[model samples]
Target: MKFKITHITTYLFDSEVFLEPHYLRFRPSQTSYVNVSELALTILPQPAGHKMVQDEDNNSVDFCWFEGMTSQLTIKAESVLETKPYNPFNFLIYPQNFNTLPFQYNVLQKKLLFSALEVVPISKVLSDYALSILQRSNFNTIPYLTNLTKQLHDDFSVEYRADGAPFIPDETFQLKRGSCRDLSWMLINVLRQQGLAARFVSGYYYFDMVKPAYELHAWVDVYLPGIGWFGLDPSHGILTGNTHFPIASSAHYEHTMPVSGGIRGSASSKLNTELIIEKL
Candidate 1:
């Protein structure tokens, strides 16, 4: 399947101001599942300079700086991509005695997966909640994760927030409501607590049930000894497939913002965005 995607972001400031180098990760990262045939970006007030750079994960990012003062800025990014069908269950053979709890990673594997395995402290409430799911799944490898993902989707109510960092996992657990990033973060921490390696994922999900619409989305990728890395969307209770086009991924969600930068003025700002995705 081929998908054409457009995303527009507008920033309106109370007063003219200078902008620091802005980072843009609007271009989808090419992977075995998806190919980007064409991509373009438009910026208003014409940047003084801009360059494309690859991050630690090899995700494409645009670094931009503005010359003169401007009270408003607009950015439009469009892309054409081809995605192949994905089978979540298509995985490599597991190492001996590696299918159950207390996963064992070799020295080399541990070093390679360190970032994804970094431990973050969470409240007892969250620890207990995650434990319950593990117990219920009998700690079965694939079933455990699948059930955990689905349970999160079924258990929590989604609260959409267009800006700001996701709620910490403990907060999300207590509130029982959070945005996609919040949920994904919660899941990432939960998996990490059990010695699983997981990382944050940001991208666009093509939804047919809704009109030709698109939005920035968040999910996670877990590292399995045999399978390497695979994605799962706790917010949607599904493994990421052909329809999920990841643009940026990092161990920290803050690094994956579609647009991020510092400004030199004290101007308050308002932001608006529009996204569209259609089948080609």
Candidate 2:
């Protein structure tokens, strides 16, 4: 499936976010600008998941409070993709992001920055459970899984919201249900906890039946021993196939918010959100 996506995030700054220089993993070091691409990419708003000013090289930093972000994405199948079923062994598992950034919760708890998260779920335990799901000796491989990258299809559940409420892990554990981000995060953490590397994916999903062919969604991918990396949507209870177009992924979703960053100067600002995903 092919899609066009629009995402916007606004920041109400008690502070400012300045541009800085730092390293972006997948691009050339000289890359200071992002261009139009149908492929996946990552953009940083604040270095450690908080608002900060950054320089051109993406290195030097200035202290700041608010950051605002917006992103438009075009995701289409790449006929000449860099990764292959056989050669993507390295990409399937989690990349060593430890060097670039620390665990989301650990950094804040240490009081390293103004960054924060309360009731941060301990991820290791969850990642372990997810890996076990993939390695089930009796699990039968879905034949389509092997042909997915080449398939032209779509599979996603109907859109739903969480009542804008947050639940503790124990609640999710007992209920075994939640929103897309919840299930996606839960599955990935379960896999990571087990020593298996996993990452949370965020982007647009579409019901192939939709005329526009896209909508906002979240899911996960885990590394498998025999197959490089495979994706799964625990909410949908199946493996992810090529029909899904991934925009960006990180240890978690905060890294892939539709928009994040701050506008240095503006009249008194207020945040308002609007979203609509239609089949057509």
Q: Largest TM-score belongs to which candidate?
A: 1
lDDT of 1: 0.88
> In order, what lDDT does every prediction score?
0.88, 0.39
- What residue runs in model 2 are displaced by over 4 Å at the alpha carbon? 1-159, 162-168, 209-215, 263-280
The local lDDT score (0 to 100) that residue 15 gets in candidate 2 is 38
TM-score for each predicted model, relative to the true structure:
0.96, 0.45
Q: Which portions of model 1 miss their true places by more than 4 Å? A: none
For 1-280, candidate 1 gives per-residue lDDT tens digits of 9999999999999999998889988998888889999999999978989999998877899989888889988999999999987888998647845678777778998888888888989988788887888888887778888988999999999777999999888899989999999999999998999998899999999878655545689999988867877889988898888899999998889889998998899999999999999898
Most lDDT-accurate candidate = 1
| Candidate 2 local lDDT, 1-280, one digit each (tens) | 1233343323344434343322221211111121223333323343344333343323222233323432211111121122112222233223333212122323332342121121245544443443344344222233222222112112223235523332444445546556777656554544343333566666545454534433357776644434444666665555654444455565545665444433433434444333322321
